[model samples]
Target chain A: MTIEQGSYESPIDRSVFDQFAARLAGDLPRPTVVETMTALLRQEIIDGAYGPGTRLPEESLSKRFRISRHSLREAMRLLVHERLLVHETHRGVRVRTVDVHDLGEIFAARRVVECAAVERASDDGAALAVVRAAVREGQQAAEAGVWATVGTADLHFHQAITALAGSSHLDELMRRLLAELRLALHVLADPRRFHEPYLERNDEIATLLERGDRTAAASALRTCLDDAERQLTAAVAA
Target chain B: MTIEQGSYESPIDRSVFDQFAARLAGDLPRPTVVETMTALLRQEIIDGAYGPGTRLPEESLSKRFRISRHSLREAMRLLVHERLLVHETHRGVRVRTVDVHDLGEIFAARRVVECAAVERASDDGAALAVVRAAVREGQQAAEAGVWATVGTADLHFHQAITALAGSSHLDELMRRLLAELRLALHVLADPRRFHEPYLERNDEIATLLERGDRTAAASALRTCLDDAERQLTAAVAA
Candidate 1:
């Protein structure tokens, strides 16, 4: 179940959850110890370092992070709120597992959010540049045969699409949604097989945006996402 | 500025945040102490029991909730993630203040979510019934001159609009967005003057949904939301 890790293949210097927490909490002067821990665990979980349903023992995490029990508990609480982890009575915390139904709901949300974003995508050069950059990154990663990087780039691409809305709230929501999507993607048997086809579709959507055909872009993206959702749902169900 | 309090006027027996937390975390056997405290405080903040920017003293909340410092800290962290509270250095956690820009961003998100939901509203009678019931509740509350209830009903109505999409993710996202909007609405000098005009619009949108005029409903909602964003932004700026 090993997937991509490291900064070279990662899309951003900060984890998606960190960016989400920062935006969500508004501009904070500093990240607390708990926040730092939460971000690391979040990235690790999404990166498949901790597979779904793996228990994160409080004592072990406290030892690993060299943080207090209080701090680790706080970090776990934050991850629970983010839906990256779940806390069960007596059993402690475990990474959340997504099933077929969960995937359907996630894809339903992606369709609503990304479709709306592309339909109203901004004409601003900078926002469009982000969409373009993500597409290039995904393409390049695929060309290099780094499917893990390709997965990260795909998340980045969708995140950029929502970013075009210029709503911090939407960005925050999209971040969480994409993180959940990453979790769902883990069920795939072959990362490259799952992500390879979407690379060209991502490029097509980017091209449509660049040409200012937002409706067409949105339509194309919707069909593509539906197909992706069906694929993922079937994988999870199996 | 006391507005609404108590269960009769409140839209739900459980706070919106509790429902959101429960759904987001998936099914769990029981709610932790931290979860209980977070829900109560979240309701208080959204209901105007604690006004925006009001610092929630740790010692007092620890006393009031009669929970340990650790439990309180965990609860506060959850609220901060939900954007109901913000933690500042040395100053401690305070209710999040929504400024004019924040209101604009929030409204932008509402437009995206509600518009998308209504545009693809489910044909299921049960779903439409919730929308209709919320509409009636608002109308009745308005006629009874319970402006606070009217305000809550409005939140319920929009929530039901998103609920039509049948996505728990959107419902959770809408809960947070609407909570932020509630904070922004606190800026209005007169609650009646602020929410009165929208009651009829809610009914109109509900009617459109009931009749399966989804496109029209979505168009109307987008314009109404735009008008609302403009009005709220002006009020906050003033």
Candidate 2:
């Protein structure tokens, strides 16, 4: 059975997806209605507004989203392709569940990509700019006392780490991995309890890279993610 | 400037995408039209039918694919999102151009994910079976002298390796990265020259994993990818 509807916590609501979407959207021509709808639903799933194993009855969702059944199906189909949602004829559609084991695996995968990024991030000024901006954004969010905003910025920080590797393909892969990460971490009721401690570690990550001490920075990040995964895994277990 | 039309060599005509679609479509339910069309175009890109930097004129593609412009746009949007196609208001849409430097970054990313997958692949019988199947599939394709199919199977072999890690998220990331790898390798007219050498290495990788020698397997795959990258890079340079 599904958890009580009142218990759902969507990461999309915290503007993590929105801030990034707006930043990426940047008036990049006209977006099709289906494209817009798909992003919205994906954000909902990422936010944990819809938990895993919960059936997504299309008839009701289409009505609620005020889109035609055809367009809603397109959006749902896209998410299913992305593995955020899974479809089985017998089961219809349900959000993919992120479990405790998933948390550990995602952390491990993150270490592989993000650590490599830390060690090999481009020294080009443009690449460093992206990483620096992420740190600044996190700092500003912390100063504003918005822990959730800080959480979103923390997601950006890891993304910037991958950017250092300078492969669009790797960057895209990291984007999907991080999305799954936020989804898995959605289980924690108070995200502040999870993200608060990492703020300084993020700065240190940036500082190490800035000074070109990639070896130490990577070691720090590996330790940082290990601790984060352990804490989140414990939280998920509870 | 556009390359000569004679220079365009598409991968889809080999029906690489079609064979898989027909096989998978049986198990899966109705695919949305957009999903179907996206698959078709993506196959074309992978097959080198739509060579890099070639414009995808929407009106023409809609007519060619025998789908509505609306559905065709949806398909194009998906590919663009995948970086197989890029959208521009002025130039319209064109297949993404992968260059020499991209070749290096992709290989670096592959080494991180694939080597890590080697180290962490689960020892359970079923997991090994998946990796075993991919290797066998490649061997069969090579025996039949179907280099393209071998190329496709090679793609699956990496997928199986990642599956050994037992992280669905990692598997998904590997799938995307491998697609880019195939697309990058798409440029070589004689794929045989590129893929023929790797069949034995794949078996070695599977053997190492099956024997539970994760460390040696990881080291072997690292060298495997490094060598493959060098060969591909040299070919691209020519």
Candidate DockQ scores, in order: 0.73, 0.35
Q: Candidate 1 — which residues are off by over 4 angstroms?
A: A1-31, B1-31
Superposed Cα deviation of residue A160, candidate 1 (Å): 1.0
Q: Against the true structure, candidate 1 has what lDDT?
A: 0.82
Q: TM-score of chain B, per candidate?
A: 0.85, 0.86
Error of 1 at A141 (Å): 1.3
lDDT of 2 by residue, A63-170 (tens): 665567777777877787777877775557787876788777778778877887776666777888788899899889988988878988999988988888877667
Candidate 1 chain B weakest ten by summed lDDT: B3-12
Docking class of 1: medium
Error of 1 at B86 (Å): 0.8
Cα deviation of A209, candidate 1, in Å: 1.4
Q: CA shift at B178, candidate 1, in angstroms?
A: 0.7
The DockQ assigned to candidate 2 is: 0.35
Interface DockQ of candidate 1: 0.73
